[model samples]
Target chain A: DAGITQSPRHKVTETGTPVTLRCHQTENHRYMYWYRQDPGHGLRLIHYSYGVKDTDKGEVSDGYSVSRSKTEDFLLTLESATSSQTSVYFCAIRPQRPSRGTGELFFGEGSRLTVL
Target chain B: AQTVTQSQPEMSVQEAETVTLSCTYDTSESDYYLFWYKQPPSRQMILVIRQEAYKQQNATENRFSVNFQKAAKSFSLKISDSQLGDAAMYFCAYWSQGGSEKLVFGKGTKLTVNP
Candidate 1:
């Protein structure tokens, strides 16, 4: 609904392989985030980009890296995929600034990744 | 860092009845926002309601309303006239006004509406 799209909606790869999940947004929002959902864990932030080339690590940023080369795209890469990394990844965008104290984020459908 | 807590792992309510989902957070910041998002089987996160910390009055959207107690740091969602379509996993999240850009979320509470 946020003009956000995720590539490889479903992926199945073997361990030790490299995987990248792409999140592209048409809205060109300033903020983009990567979150993974697992049973009993709800959702945890992996990484987020506030602007082009600006990225920050989240609580569970281990073994995961992100790159935002353009305003409309954010990429999440796993150098070496592991079975523990198998989870549903989500992409979300926040409009403008949060100083206004209000604004709900729009999220993409999600990308389900499985490691064999 | 702020953390959210959803004590109930799952809840059940009969059709046309009412149900409440409990959420609490630990934060030292006074200015912030709270949100409730619903994720159905389709896995799409839909905004159910939002509450602003500065506003004393509770926030409501149609049949969905939030009872926010800033002092107690408890935000509970009340659903009236629960329908089968209301069955989904609900998440409670928090965001600071001028601080943290991250929107921290709780584990989640799954709601089941029985016919």
Candidate 2:
């Protein structure tokens, strides 16, 4: 298992409230990603960071934003919590120089969020 | 755009039996990578196996193996002598060799190992 930790393992918030999920990694990996898993939708990428201050949009980055000011911490924030955002969010890390051609992702336990 | 498709929503296999999970992906890029991730009830994504598009040989790890057919755009996972520990949601994923390392995952197939 990777030394990755996600804060607020479980959360319940109102629909209009803003929520922020934090992911911390001790491995100091250069690549970090955020994904949401819902029934029938599997895991959809919300956003990812290649390096500190370098971020990019993912397939489902509409209402979500991510920041990586420090190498060890990556944060995902929901502008306005919605029921559709209720899902298990996972944080993953990969080495900057991948040993194998296939980049394998080491994930955190996951954060379960519910929007009422 | 790249897309991964896992045709089976759910699958069951008896203990000590073999089971195959199918996956197909679409990509215009010539060089890429394919992977199988296992998400147990705990919801931790674990890497099971991986196959490089440029390699013709399949990838095997312990009880897991993948049949990679680049020409057909098919990547399937075969578990030999399935055990109860193998019961989980298996996802097929794709990643480009260049550009970005972020993966695109398919709707996972739930696998049940019958006791």
Candidate 3:
């Protein structure tokens, strides 16, 4: 538990509405990632940030966006929610240059979002 | 792009028994890393074991161990002396050596431990 926290542990929003999930870390890790967990998809990367103000798209980035203004916070937003966007969103962080190729990833509890 | 695959969707084991979960991946890069993550009902993802592709020796952590087959692109997790706490969804993940350090995970295999 690297002091990672995800806000709105559970949420329900109507379709076409915008939604944002926040991830906060206290470890000051340089890398942060956002992933959505679906029933059959496991965990699919939605977006990731390497440093402050640096962000990149992931495998399932089509309907999502992320921003990291500070090293401790990363936010994932859905411009317009969709039914398919309903899933458990997770935030992960890894210390800069993980040693020994272990590439350890610390994950938040998770945020469950539903779209109606 | 790297991909991880877990062939078994569900598995069961009895207490004090040994159980192995299979995982395979597709990667062109020779030097990379593999990991097994466990997510219990608590919904928190915990790292169980990790293996480096370059290392021929398998990695073990307590009751958990990994059988890393670099040539076959196979990484499997074996849990010995299984306990009820071992019942969880196990995920296989892959990460490249360089760049963003993003992880690609498999669908996961649910492990049920029967007392």
Candidate 4:
């Protein structure tokens, strides 16, 4: 186990509501990523943080945003929930020490979101 | 842009048999990494195997191995002695070595192991 925990294991919210999902890791990994998994679609990266206050957009970062204020915590927020945002979100972390291709990713249990 | 493709949407194999899942990727970068990740019913992603483009030899983790055909741009995963536990969604991913750590993933293949 990577000691990764995602808050609000499941959530159901109405459209236009703001929702934030928290990902906490005890491993102190330097790289943290937020991704969404939809049916028939593979996991798509939304955003990732290399360090505290350092973040970058991913392939599917249009409606979602992420912030990492500390090494162990990464947060993903949906400014206004949409029906299209209803999917499972996952948090992943990779150690900083090993070279680029050295470390494997450790993922959280996942958070299921439903927007009506 | 890098793209990963898993042509098979679903596959089934008898327990104790061997099965190979196909995955192909398109990327112009020469230096990169290929990986196979397994997502079980728990929805927890687990790394099955990884292959570095620079390495000529294939990567094998226990019964899981990858056939890396860099020239053909194909990376396929083969599972030997399949077990019921192997039933899950398998995703093939690609990551460039150009400092961008984000991975491009395939749609995934749902594998079912029957006894």
Each model's lDDT: 0.95, 0.92, 0.92, 0.91
**Tens digits of per-residue lDDT for model 4 on B27-113?**
889999889999999888988988989999999999999899999999999999999999999999998887678888999999999
TM-score attained by model 3: 0.96
Model 3 Cα shift for residue B13 (angstroms): 0.8
Once fitted onto the true fold, the runs of candidate 4 whose alpha carbons sit more than 4 angstroms away are A99-103
Whose lDDT is higher: candidate 1's or candidate 2's? 1
Task: Tell me the DockQ of each model, to 2 decimals.
Answer: 0.79, 0.83, 0.82, 0.72
lDDT per residue for candidate 1 within B1-115, as digits (tens), equals 8999999999999999999999999999988999999999999999899999999999999999999999999999999999999999999999998658889999999999999
Of 1 and 4, which scores higher on lDDT? 1
Considering DockQ, where higher is better, how would the candidates rank from best to worst?
Answer: 2, 3, 1, 4
Model 2, C-alpha of A26: deviation from truth (Å): 1.1
Q: In model 2, which regions exceed 4 Å deviation?
A: none
Clashing pairs in 2: none
Cα lDDT tens digits, model 2, A3-106, are 99999999999999999999999988888999999999989999999999999999899999999999999999998999989999999998755573457788
Superposed on the true chain A, the predicted chain A of model 4 yields a TM-score of 0.94
Clashing pairs in 1: none
What is the DockQ score, from 0 to 1, of model 3?
Answer: 0.82
lDDT of each residue in A14-113, candidate 3, tens digit only: 9999999999999888889999999878999999998999998888899898989998999999999999999999999887544624577889999999
lDDT at position A80, candidate 1: 99
Per-residue lDDT for B22-107 in model 3, tens only? 99999988778899999999999988988888889999999999989887999999999999999999999998877547888999
